[model samples]
Target: MSNKSEALSRRFEAAFMPNYGVPPVALARGEGSRVWDVDGAEYLDLIGGIAVSSLGHAHPALVEAVSRQVATLAHTSNLFLHEPEVLLAERLIGLLGAPARVFLTSSGTEANEAALKLAIKYGKANGRPYVVAAENGFHGRSLGALSLTGKASIRDQFGPFPADVRFVPYGDADALKNAVTAECAAVFLEPTQGEAGVVPPPDGYLRAVREICDTTGALLVTDEIQSAIGRTGHWFAHQHDGVLPDVLTLAKGLGGGLPIGACVGFGDAGTLFAKGDHGSTFGGNPVSAAAALAVLDTIESQGLLEHVKTVGTLLAEGIASVEHPLLKGVRGRGLWLAVVLTAERAARFQTAAQHAGFLVNAVQPDAVRLAPPLVITAEQVTSFVTALPALLDEASHD
Candidate 1:
């Protein structure tokens, strides 16, 4: 770390909790898909803040919407109605092509927590007592959300959660079918498991899960927190399989960078929650709502969804063209791809990529995840791909 970076780290340690440890670089500014550290070192942000920066940094639409909304109206505390909040909810439901009720929150885990509560209530009323989730699936760290998560390492440390939850291996249709029984109230899954190295289930897996949920009279809850909002070339990743979930949890890219989350319930699930059943203080704050609106509008107007598909394909091809022994190929949809590596060199590769002026995430021991801004250009994708050979070489030696 540079002197300036070290000084910032010191200040951060002095004033902040040590939960995240200290970051290697202290970012000073960002524009489009690039960010600069305090020491003036620039980098291409390929991870997009873990798939949250949908429109990239300092986007005009987001800036204008937030600035305009904050200047006009910012908060209502869910006690009063706001136009931006209502409009955002309507827009999201319209995108889903369904009639649903939304419970907006401050983050994705909170959304999942709300969804779990809804499920438990609905199930308790229906005489069901168990919830099923996929192994390696990440919901969040809050107690309830953490319980629903299937990762043993993260969840086991924080338990015991208040909910009775079961886990099945991800993408295993037969295991899921056997696990989700009549006693199961809900089955939670990700249309595409993002944190598990951008893992996508087999084709027809979601449909099978839906069928199982239907047979067992259980609600199908899909966590679209990381895969939704055009991250996977679709508004909702489950839509690619032509299925609608009973409950959908959304966050990450929902506010295009602002902190926001939503638990959207469809059909009977939508009407399950009555007044005072659930609420949030900053849920759907006008400014975040406006920012979300800007993000959706920008995705539609600029045709970034299609752009993501095209550029994402280009990137996959570019990266695959390299014949390095370290390369294991890429897997994912749209901009959410995992560059597979042959060895347990992912953390080293991340460091090398950082040194090479590109940002990526080591989501697993052998997977480097790439979820760049939706506005990232073809040239930027190509640039990252071209830099990978040398980065891999450095990682190999390191």
Candidate 2:
């Protein structure tokens, strides 16, 4: 590492909490699906900052938007209205092609937090106070969001959490139906369990969940923080099953690398949170909202949705053609793909691939999740595929 890099890393460790441990590299800069370490070594940013950089590093549109907005008006409290906030909300609702209202925040956790509060209010209004979530599903780290998350390792440390939260087996309609009672207020789920190694639900699962929610009068809440915004080919992953969620939580790529989150509600559920029920100081700040608008505009103008679907298919097929036993198969849609291995060697493979000039994420011990920017090229996918066997070989030895 350079002197500058070492000094910065040391300062970072000293100043920041130790929850995530040490970061592997001190990044200097990024551009168009690639990032450079402080030492000037470049690597393909395959994970896209955990699926946040939808337009990749430093897209011109995003750069221009943030720059212009910061100069014009960066922030204004919720006491006043802002043009970017209003426009972005309209864009989100229009994108969903459904009647919805939006509540914006600064991060995915906050988005889920708002959704949780909305669920509670909606339930109380309708005489149901219980909430049902799926096993292995991840929401966020805040108290309410953490309570709904089904991962024992994450939730175990924080409890005893709020009561009346239940976990049902994901993709299991029977289990979901059995768990959701008429007293349930909502059913929270991830269309594809991204953190659980990109586990896509079984066919008809989402539609089935929708049916269960309807039958039980429970609001269907889909946390799409990791899967929405063209990451999954469709605008939202739930659309693959022709199902519509009552409440949808989005973040990650919504701001194209800038931090932003949105909780959108449909129908009467949209009005559950009255004026003072929830609010955020920095939610929908003009700068972040402008950044989101630029991302949406570029996604449409550049036809990134079709690009995601096309290049994503190529990447999946190319990886599968590698023909390695430890390599199981690819799951997920659009630019969001996960390479599954037979054993828990994901961290090993991740290190090996990093050395080979690619950045990836070990979402689990047995899987590496790939969420490259929607703008990533076919050539880059081909290069990564070509380098996979060597990465696997090194991982196998480790």
* Reference-based lDDT, residue 126, model 1: 88
TM for candidate 1 is: 0.99
Give all candidates' CA lDDT scores: 0.92, 0.92
Pairs clashing within candidate 2: none
Hey, what RMSD does candidate 1 come out at? 0.9
Off by over 4 Å in 2: 1-4
lDDT of 1 by residue, 277-321 (tens): 989999999999999999999999999989998998999889889
For each candidate, what TM-score against the reference?
Answer: 0.99, 0.98
RMSD value for candidate 2: 1.0
- The runs of at least 3 residues in candidate 1 whose Cα sits more than 4 Å from the true structure, single-residue gaps closed, are none
* CA RMSD per model (angstroms): 0.9, 1.0
